[model samples]
Target: MTTTTAIGYENNLPTNDPASLIERTIDVPALGAHDLLVEVRAVSVNPVDVKLRAGAHAGGFRVLGFDAAGIVREVGDAVTLFAPGDEVFYAGSIDRPGTNQRLHGVDERIVGRKPRSLSFADAAALPLTAITAWETLFDRFALTPDDTGTLLVIGATGGVGSVMLQLAEALLPGVTVIATASDPERAAWVRELGAEHTVDHHGDLAAQVLSLAPGGVDWLFTAHSEGQIGLYSQIVRPFGQITAIDDGPRDIAPLKAKSITWHWKLMFTRPLHQTPDLIEQHRLLDTVAGLVDDSRLRTTTTRTLTPINAATLREAHELVETGRTLGKIVLHDGN
Candidate 1:
């Protein structure tokens, strides 16, 4: 049995408003045959949370967190991967109430044991970014661990880009990484994370990339503005794959001229739709944990806020919306 206690809104509305997040307690139903009861210790905010909170939807209070690191308080009858008291981390399904509360019931199939070396705040930032970067490299672009080629990452100091740069260095040995950071501080940050080269995104992207790799990059991952889709195509090698996680109105015709392949990576697609490969999220997260524990992959949490509440969450949202966050912003502990 799992006790239900949470803090969330009462109706669909913008969280930017002071009254939008009405803290309240509610009953969490008993765990299903395959669910695990989680006592959330820390949670991270992403662009998705802000969008969902402000969007028009059915008039009902919905929880809006995706990334969490916590302790397992209970387990379903059929659960084998985890047990009560196990420390874990996960990005819960978007279709369900999120981890913004004191406790959350999540499917064990998409959760991983927390890294032994990381604090809950650090672990909380890894699930969403790690999954996005891993899937983009291995699943979408089909880049192998041994692939030795030049890779380009746009918005290199962002949540996903920070992790993607580290993963590329750790997994793809001998591969050269070119990362884009518009400012000097971000460029230094990306280089510290393992980028072989860095360029300013504020200038001509195609020209800067061409100057670094005269032939063109073998793979390009865009974590920033979707408006640069055409620009990416112009700098990618023939038959090279370009992957993006952001969505916006843009012309993709430029890719056709270079015979460049375009790939869209939505990290939530598998969990949101309950696809047959939903278990892959579990496997990938576990792998990430092992890497972290072994001192291979690094956490990307750049800022932390104490006491989870509407005010603190709103501040975190403002940081993300500013479009200048280097890594992730996390909120921990219930007030």
Candidate 2:
């Protein structure tokens, strides 16, 4: 591949419009001093991508994607973390154009070495989900790697929840992990990922959780309905932390009464705002890579699509929108 041959989807109209599927040829910006020009091998679709595309302001022929694994084709003068020909993977900044293309210009601070044990498609599934799970557990909840308290993972079969289950199981040894999945297959899936117990979210969550722990759960990680905040409060012990990745219009007063600590995990906030600690994403991703390469953790890519294009991307988006995907869905460059 030259400095080009990039393939990606471009939406010129609102996502609700029928003509939003337009595709075109364009040049990615040259590498900045702190950037890496990556030859994208695989990309993953997340729910945020679908939500953003469906919004009214989805314009400017925007390139929309986040998770990607690829080869570093060129490095800027200031880049030191990676070199040309290095293999890398990352969940690109939401504020920047994304990695849906064959070529992507990425900031070095947000990228990490791809796990040596995983394929490009597998590695592509990890970055976004891993970042969310890590930030939610370690950053937002302030849970240490060795904390052995019982953690209740609501909706633990979804993308972020799947990785969260693995991270907790791998890093927090002896910690009782109670995961919630609505169906039998999803419940089994979470168990296979190392969850100690799985409960049905459609049932009484507090009762089911109590049946397992007897004492209320010490920590709660919710990847599902924000409307269930009250349910979380009932299941978490007083002074316990409850972190969620869901955006809410629901009341958290139930948590207030229980003295439950509430935290919202938005993985894109740091990169989107360019916060002072934005470099932490890079550090976390690097740590995750180490875990992957060492075989302590696994990539979550569950589905793959051939050739990156608009129609294929639409299919991936539709699957995510269905709310039943077991892990990550990826699209490779058809190499």
Candidate 3:
């Protein structure tokens, strides 16, 4: 096909507006030497998509999405890891157009073979969150199988935390996870994902955590930390490390006495920077696929919508903005 159908937006607007997302046909994106032309089958929404939509001011329509599961339709000359017909999953680069189109082009280095056990919709839920979770644990926290300590995860029922807990269960035998959930449903959900303990984020976090671990947790990872640094400072052990995929803490003054080290992780960093280790994403996705096929890890897809289009995309974006979602929300072309 010379062109493909896509859902995108021409300006920043409230998702409730009919103009927020529009369907159009555009020329199929050109491929770089390492790019793969993929026929996208499924996609999942992330908070980044919501943020970008509200703040973006593209001169033309800007496609919005990151996570995708698809099949290779064509491969660039330098691509050796995959070829036409290979089933694949990946989170596209922040610097690129994205994967919300019928045909999307992405670097092969950031793509992976989709898990044989999962359908495209299920597979789509894994890439973006899985990449962020994997990077937060192994790359930012530098966790290993031999490491023995407590990991406190805020927003434990959200996309990243859901997968992070599962990855820890499969990869970190010695580590104990304590997750923060707002209510009974979320609390029970995180426990099933391998959280050793769950604390109510709406209650006394420090007291609850202190009751669970008197000396405080060894590491802390939070998805949203706009004004929670004071609370976090009271629970983390001295010299403990912290990583945040969101805005992180508002103030570090309370944490200074404990000599805490805070790190920021955005899975897009490597790809946007074109880092030497950009291909690590490919390796990690392949590894996660193996885990999924082995039944050691599972997709966190909580809801699936069909017939990806303007209306559906806007609906999916609004669902994410509600902040009540348990896991990932996905949409597919039904191909």
Candidate 4:
């Protein structure tokens, strides 16, 4: 029997208590035909990690982590994209056991070769946020280098925002990216990442955006659309597109008058639904790795905790729950 160290929880409890997570050895299941058994070297925490951890536990222990970079230790017979010894980065499928374990199995279709220029910890921070930002800008919103417009990004200093601003500057030429940051530090952070202007999200977001683009922004991407939907509707220009990566129950009725198109960017959709376009994730991740190597995209890893374990993971969760994390926090293998 093969087993690996993992951080898991049997109950959904507040991360503030520090006893919410536990460490244990878990069985590593045999791989499926298209699976790659990876030896996870580093893993990053996302809001989803916290959400899933806080949700009701379905049964036994639940391991929660999505972004990871590691070396391929074994591959199932049908796996062709990667093989033993290959280094890769990926956001694991939401329905499957997560990447919190030392050994994780993920479909090769959703994994990509890691950026050779980055360390395991840095690479681990890119996958989840990169996929979400890439999909939001290029796929959902369809921004192109040829198209010129203003892009308004709400919550522009966190993990996804850090990558989104960089991708916008790298992929969409002639576009002015305005990001909302509630503090001076975060504002400076977004500007460093390529945001042309920074507005306070806690203040009058619409007025601040209006001061920059009198007619309102041509496109908007927000991680807090549910709470800021009304503000979004007011600040996005007519016919503008909006992509929200945050979980929804967002009311789109306010968008009707402007004839705006609102879309959701769920990075895990391809893998979770087994969509035919699952390979697109692999292709985009590959492109992201290339961009990273080219210095066109920067890793958002702001902090790393050593010796991946329950205490460290719980600490990461606490940071995430603060809702003020500037970038991604990663956990590196103790060994």
Leading candidate by lDDT: 3
Stronger candidate by TM-score (1 vs 2)? 1
Please give, for residues 1-335, the per-residue lDDT of candidate 1 as tens digits. Answer: 34455555655555467766666667775788889989999999988776676664624667778999999988999899998999999999877888888879899989999999999999999998899999998999888866888999987898999999999888898689999888888989999999999998888888999999998999998866467766776789998988888774367887887888888888888878888998899999999999998899989999999888777877787688777998999888741
State the lDDT of candidate 3 residue by residue for 1-335, as single tens digits. 79999888998999889998888899999999999999999999999999989897767989989999999999998999998999999999989988899999999999999999999999999999999999999988899999999999998899999999999999999999999988888988999999999998888889999999899999898988888888888999999988898876566888899998898888999889999998999999999999999999999999989888889989999999999999999998673
lDDT of 4 at 324: 90
Model 4 lDDT per residue over 1-335, tens place: 48888888888888776658888788985899999999999999999999888886737888888999999999999998997999999999989988999899999999999999999999999999999998988889887799998999887888998999999889887899999888889989999999999998778777889999999899898888766668777899999999888776546888899999999888989999999899999999999999999999989989999988888999999999999999899999752
Q: Measured by TM-score, how close is model 1 to the native structure?
A: 0.94
Instruction: Kindly report which residue pairs in candidate 2 clash with one another.
Output: none
Which lDDT value does model 2 have at 109? Answer: 87
Candidate 1 vs candidate 2: the lDDT winner is: 1
TM-score, per-candidate, Cα-based: 0.94, 0.93, 0.98, 0.97
The lDDT per prediction is: 0.85, 0.82, 0.92, 0.90
Candidate 1 residue-wise lDDT at 212: 90
